[model samples]
Target: MRIYLVTPRNPESFWTYDRILPSLGKRCIFPNLSMPTVAGMTPRDHEIVLCDENVEEIDFDVEADIIGVTGYIVHKPRMLEIIAEFRRRGRFVVVGGPYASLCPEDLRGTCNVLFVDEAEETWPQFLADFARGAPQAEYRPAEKPDLTTSPTPRFDLLKVDQYHAMTIQFARGCPFNCEFCDIIVVYGRRPRVKGVPQVMAEIEECHRLGATQVFLVDDNFIGNKKLAKELLRTIATWSEAHGHPMYFNTEVSLNVAQDDELLELLRAARFTTIFIGIESPRKASLQETKKTQNMRGNLVDNVRKIQSYGIQVQAGMIVGFDADDESIFEEQLRFIQDARIPVSMTGMLQAMPKTPLHERMAKEGRLIAESVGDQFVFSNILPKAMSRIELYKGYRKLIAELYEFRNFRTRTLEFILNRGRQVGEGLAIRREELRLAARVLRDTVLSTSPRRAWFTLSLLGATLMKRPAAIADALAFAIVHKALYEYMQSLDHHLERVIGEIEAATETMTAAAVNA
Candidate 1:
């Protein structure tokens, strides 16, 4: 049977930066790794075509026996649309990935089949059954498959020119169980890592395809320290021998700061940045959320320690825990600013379906009376102590303060001065830094608006004259923030629409109750 794997397009959100990214000559940051992975899992006899709507237009008229759509919670609406479009054409549509895996009921009417959980164990069987003209309504893996057997994803199917980086996964799952996180629920707590040779082979494939930067799309890359160290050591040797063609990035727990050898290995492997989930600064909040691993040391100091190894930190922070009150937003912002974390991906707490937090909320009668799709569109649930409006206002204020040019520039400079001293190790590295600085300077000085040009120049002058070491760091921060600011503006508009819809729904419910 012919198969077309689909990744649906995301409606631009407050956090979308596509519009302003042209100024920096960057496209979207990361490509879809899941759909391609599913494509890789298909048996050799079956013909497979992959289309990521983010990079390609969907051809509804394209003839295929089966359509496979995969996405996460945020992309549910688009996934539903894709399924409906295919089903309307009398084609069999399979829905899977995090959203469908967590709650298959939401996809019942739209999808002819639901392949939940990891695809490796179930996908081959699903294809075999479909080829026999017997497609089941649902398919799930009986057990998690070993990562070593997973194929190098079908990167050939991607439009490499349309993205800033290609993604590869070395590992799955996390060791720590943060309450709000869905990683453990989805992949389990015992970390599973691909063998070093398997990972290196994938990297070699990406290199052969001219991918200069690869994101290791692991929830916690170093969660298994011994295995991770082994892989990094091999990667370091391979990268050095091959002229270090690719720079790596991945997410990890903050405990990475405790291991000096691991940090050295990561730097040697050309790993430049890490996304750490430093959820909150308040120790009580951390404990409340069961993120006790982060409470092991001074939070800011741990972050600085990682930065000392020349790895930039892009952290995730959330407000609205049971222990949190109104002051949480300001405190969170101050902590982020004080740490000089350039990319602070702050969001209101979301009790995702099937998460421990969600179960507890449902038990306590705190789960918002709305569908999972609605929650994805807006911050639907609220903390027990705070009103919904207060939470929304607080989120807005925090984002506004964090992205303001003056505050962003100041914090970035401070972070650079603190971390830049550790990065001046060799001539080659220095040359790369200078090249990036030059490009950033050109982009900033030649901005579209005169006011933007003046602001960019002023910020550039401040970094170069006041703290020369900070120029590279400041440039990186500016590129990310410029895109983030544009995305946040879009998000604000989305939030307003979501609020209006919620109000209308509430009014309709009230009127129906009165009539009854």
Candidate 2:
């Protein structure tokens, strides 16, 4: 039997980083680890082929008995479209992932089989039933599986060199209930962790496959602090034994800063970056969202302490919440700049399906529409403090200002200068990567514009002069931010057109209502 796994590509988003990948001569930011993992779970006798639509085009003509597809918010429409084509070609379609787990009804009729929630338990069961010429239309696990039983993701199945980094997951859940987040809703709040040996073996597989940079794709890596430390210690030992080949990064709540020893372990384990979801600094907003972990400490101080350990922070912030006002946007911008978070993402509040925020908004009759995919897009929920129009406008302004050249440069410089940088012993930066990074920076300066060129040259040249060892990593940062700045410009242009079209349609509706 031939099983084809498809990862629907995100056309335009910060996550894919497709716009930035070309300059670095890499195929994609990271391979969709979910597809490969699911492929691994299937019996080895079956011929499993994985295609990431972001990196390569989907071969709709490919022959396969079963087609397994997965994706998140951005991939919903694309998945539906792809499923239709498969069904027409007389193929069986199975749909599952974060989007399907929460919004199963969306694909009810489209999929021949639906596997909601964790597939670790349900996948094998479905395969057995199908082999016997009998399969359920839908199969959801009665409870989250013990993550320890999870199989190693099929890293060997991937085209290793195409990706700049490989990804693996160490844990399954987050302890805190952030109202808008869907992680807890899908994988319970108890934080089911993988055993230390399991995680170490996965990393070793990545290392063996030539993956130097590995991302721990857990929503919050330290949800179970004790388990996290154990994993880190094992990772440090394995990385050392393997000659310090694998560097790691992941997301953690702000509370990770409180544990000084944990931070040391992460650095010793060769973690160069961490993404903190410091939603908002406003006490009222944090309280409203139930992100209680962030409220415990001075947000700015926590960020600084974490960065001081040589693990630079890439923060995630939100602008649309019940307590948010017009002032919130500027506050977010100011806080990010002050905190020296060089790479921060600001998203409008979106009440994802079945999340606490979604339920509350639906009860209040504030949810005007249900079409939400892109994080940068407006929420279906209407804000109590502001209009939908105001929310979109503020979000656009915030993103634009945050990525503005001068502000971006200032933030980057501040972050690099103050960052508690990890020792270079574990880093395996290749000479070719350095040269490609240099070309991207050089072109951005000489070709982008005189002002941009000057800023790029001056800022990077100074950093290289002071910290020559930072040249490769700094160049990688430069490549990312430059793409981000350009992507922001494109978003601005797209949003203006969309808003204009919306206004025109609204006026037409009003005119029609008056005539009626």
Candidate 3:
């Protein structure tokens, strides 16, 4: 059998790091772990090829027995187009991943085979059936497969040099159920993780492939604390033994601040970054969205505590909610600045399919359209407190204020000053990272834009003076801020057009009602 695994292209957004990738000499941030893992699932006798559309163009004419496409909601439009192109070329097409798994009905007529939930068990079944000349239109597991037996991803298939980081998964599912989150719906709440040896092997594989930065890509790294500690301890030991060839990062709930031991294990394992969903500071919004974990403690203090352990906290914040009003935007902005989180990814609240929020919105007849996963530009649900136009305008204003040159610099500097010290191994910067840093510095120094040049140079000086050991990290933050500021600037025209259309439509309806 011949297989071609494809990951669709993502639109230019903060996560894409589109602007900075050029300076860093990378195609994308990282490859999605799904494709490589799926490649690993194929039989050894079969030929497998993998391509990330973000990094390379897809050849519709490729000679392959079957085409497998996977992506999140952000890539749905591109995924559909890719699948249609392949099927139009008379190739078998299969669709899966977060978007398909959450809303398979949306993909029903578009592809020959659709996979839902975990694919470890269903992928092999589909392969066997296809070989026998009879394949199911859809494959969904009756129960979640054991991750302990999951196969190591075929990282060899990926163009490692093109990516800035490598991706691996240590676990799936989250213990907490945030109403808008799709993880719990897809993976269940009982965190399932791979064996320690399996995880170490994946790490070793990544290291052997010249990957210095690896993302764990877990739904919540500490969802199961006991298991997570066990894994972290093993990782700490193995990383020390291997001279910390790869520094790790992952996502976790903010409740991790309460666990000092887990924080120690993470620092000991040389995990340099952790993304936490500090969705909102408003207690009402938190309760409305069922993200009570964030409300358990002082959000600002928790973030600082995490940073105190020398782990950079990249935050995820949302604005739209039933409990949010016009004032919520300022609240979010103030909270982000107060938290001193350098990379605060704020987006409009989206009612993703299969989540509790989506169901409630549907029941209330508030779902306006399917969410496209670009939170800055789109929101599917009609808010209870503000009109759609108002929501969009407020969100745009909030983003502008948050990423404004002065504010961005202040927060970034504060973070660096408070980022604390690295307590464990892996302190030395790798040769590749130094090269990236030099490139970043050179680009910023040569930049024609005054705001960008000042932002990087100013941050560079402060980091050099206060935390010289973190000069590379400071440069990385400056690059990300540059990407985000440029991305927002690119969206201005499109956003204004969308808002104008909505406002015009609203006025038309209002005038018609008055005339009647």
Best by lDDT: 3
Candidate order by decreasing lDDT: 3, 2, 1
- Per-residue lDDT over 178-244 for candidate 1, one digit per residue giving the tens place of the 0 to 100 score: 8888888889999998899888888898888777789998999988999999999998888878776
Clashes of each: 3, 3, 0
lDDT of 3 by residue, 382-404 (tens): 98898888899999898888889
Residue pairs clashing, model 1? 14-487, 14-490, 14-491
TM-score against native, each model? 0.90, 0.95, 0.97
TM-score of candidate 2 versus the correct structure, residues matched by position: 0.95
| lDDT assessment of candidate 1 | 0.78
Query: What ranges in model 2 sit over 4 Å off?
Result: 425-429, 501-516
| Candidate 3: stretches off by over 4 Å | 423-428
List model 2 lDDT by residue over 233-305, tens digit each.
8888877776776678999989998999999999989898999999898989999999888988788888989
- Show the colliding residue pairs in model 2: 310-420, 310-421, 445-453
How well does model 2 score by local distance difference test? 0.84
State in Å the error of residue 188, model 2. Answer: 0.9
